[model samples]
Target: MSLTHSVNMNWKLLIGVLAGLLIIGMFSGSSGQQSSSAGQQSQSRALEASNSVEWKKVDFLELELPANIQELRDQVKITSGKAKFFDQEIFYQTGAVPAGVSRSGRTVLLLHGAAFTSQTWIDKVPTLRTLAALGHGVIAIDLPGYGKSSQASVPDNGEFLARLIQSLAGKQPIVVSPSMSGSFIIPMLANPQYRDLISGWVPVAPVSTGLVASFSSQLLTPTLIVVGENDRSLGNRSKEDLKGLPNATLPQVLPGAGHPAYLDQPEMWHKLLHNFIIKVNQANSAQFMEA
Candidate 1:
């Protein structure tokens, strides 16, 4: 072979190698662009899901409830007692339906905030009697370290709460948790087994909501997120974080109220609570009928 022929062969080989490298780079760039586009689309869908479900809009006006627990007590029968709860005496108030009225078989477990106790449901707002009047059994318990209930020696809030509910609340009670009690309720809610035990959840400007934010989409025990419009931090942040839940409703915000909004507007707050209870019962009934 001549030198000229050898040089021509080398040039042909070099051209082929360059063309192959160029083709590979093109495919790599296209793949990177496709991956980036897929990521953006996923993020966009998540954002849409977060924003699509609007909050349940109810007209709320901040008003002082008539200061008369006696009036409410006279209307419904309320009994106070303490039950033994695993080394702690758990004090509670039971507002039974008026003697003749048929029972709805629904029990509501009322848990208080850091600043309040079981009596806050009875004295401050007549919450127990008001709910009882609706034909549902309402029990307001003084959590350990607050009110009449003995302080818990155990460190696990979730275990303590689960045991209390199982021992006290008869079969899938609707739990009403407010403020600091979120520390207890949020942990309980994170467990799927415990979630099965609760029929419904009402979290009122609950703290520690961030703990569940990452997996809240799976925490689907029909939840009603209640908050005050004036509560700018925990309330709003929780609303945003929890709104992504598949079965959660948009938050119920009380106008001109702050943290622990129920105290600020008891009448409106009670009305909302009653409505939520009714909704939960109806849903349960429907499921039973379907089954």
Candidate 2:
């Protein structure tokens, strides 16, 4: 390798090491300090996720990715601090649709996968927003330190999300969690405490490879498991997670897509969501009418 290239790689590696140290140190604070000092943490976090412009600070776009996917992903260099949902106050616009636009028919809780912030839905938002205009609420949330809410270290991710869901949903919400977030949803629903708070669940390409047991008969209630053809084991695992519940729907696998279809194919994701919302609302209305 050229001397210049080697030097660049070194700088990026150094930045990544520093970021790792800070992440560990910040989370290692005493309980009080962690809580108090956390409220005052700076919004900027520059973790070097890839080997680009090594001498510079860590940017969001430099992560390890395939060239095609990299070309598809266009995010900002700056990473902002977003709070965990239930940890603090996060205000959603009236009508529970989304941050932008109006006139949505149903509330959609968009739960993102791990290692990604809520902004991963940026490309998917436009398509979702269209449905919002036609009457479907879509919300993409950041898990603790992921997006532009408030920042906190993610220790108990499941509990954190449970609390976060309570705060964000306020009332019962129709949740749609993709990949790892899908696993979070299962635990959230199985808990009687949260089961009542969730109107329905939609797991997209879940990452519950080892959590198949959670899908026992009691957990199903208007659940939809979506997957992609290219997703190898997640589909089967997702099936297992919601196993005994007849109320849970089978996997709605997308064509020509992989594990991350929500981001990889926003249009397809939107269509699937649109159809699901309509069906859910329709069924809910019928039950009410019958009553």
Taking all chains together, each candidate's TM-score versus the true structure is: 0.74, 0.60
lDDT of 2 at 89: 37
**lDDT winner:** 1
- What C-alpha lDDT does candidate 2 achieve relative to the native structure? 0.54
Question: Model 1, range 87-187, lDDT digits (tens) per residue?
Answer: 77888889878765567888999998989999998778777887776678888988888888747455688888898889889988989998888988888
Looking at candidate 2, the ten consecutive residues that score lowest on lDDT are 42-51
Regions of candidate 2 where Cα sits further than 4 Å from its true position: 1-105, 124-127, 154-159, 209-215
Per model, state how many residue pairs clash.
Answer: 1, 13
What is the lDDT of every predicted structure here?
A: 0.77, 0.54
